[model samples]
Target: MRTATPPPPPAALTVPEVMTALRLSRSKVYDLLRTNQLKSFTAGCARRIPTEALRQYIDNQMGEAA
Candidate 1:
């Protein structure tokens, strides 16, 4: 029997990934970061968004809609 492959570890998302995920423009994603609506960190010159932060943002939006 073949063993199943383990899933890859979660990784921080780049700005482009966030844009694709949210279907928002690059400026909009940066706007969210600027306004503190989304949390992120910079490593050197690269900005990355944690998966949990994105999830929380989504949850907050859902809550607001209800």
Candidate 2:
């Protein structure tokens, strides 16, 4: 029998998804977006955050902590 490959992660994440992942409030997530700390873009009036940008933000936070 052949094994099936796992599905890939989303290329972008919703604000609520980010909030849950980062343990942040809705306002805090928007604040990060407004401050440009967390990069995001709009898709037909819906905002989405790229997975890579989220990773970069985490990396930056780690660097700052060190």
Tell me the tens digit of each residue's lDDT in model 2 across 1-66: 999999999999999999999999999999999999999999999999999999999999999999
Question: Candidate 2 vs. truth: CA RMSD?
Answer: 0.7
lDDT of each: 0.96, 0.98
List the candidates' TM-scores in order: 0.89, 0.95
Candidate 1 global lDDT: 0.96
Candidate 2 deviant stretches above 4 angstroms: none
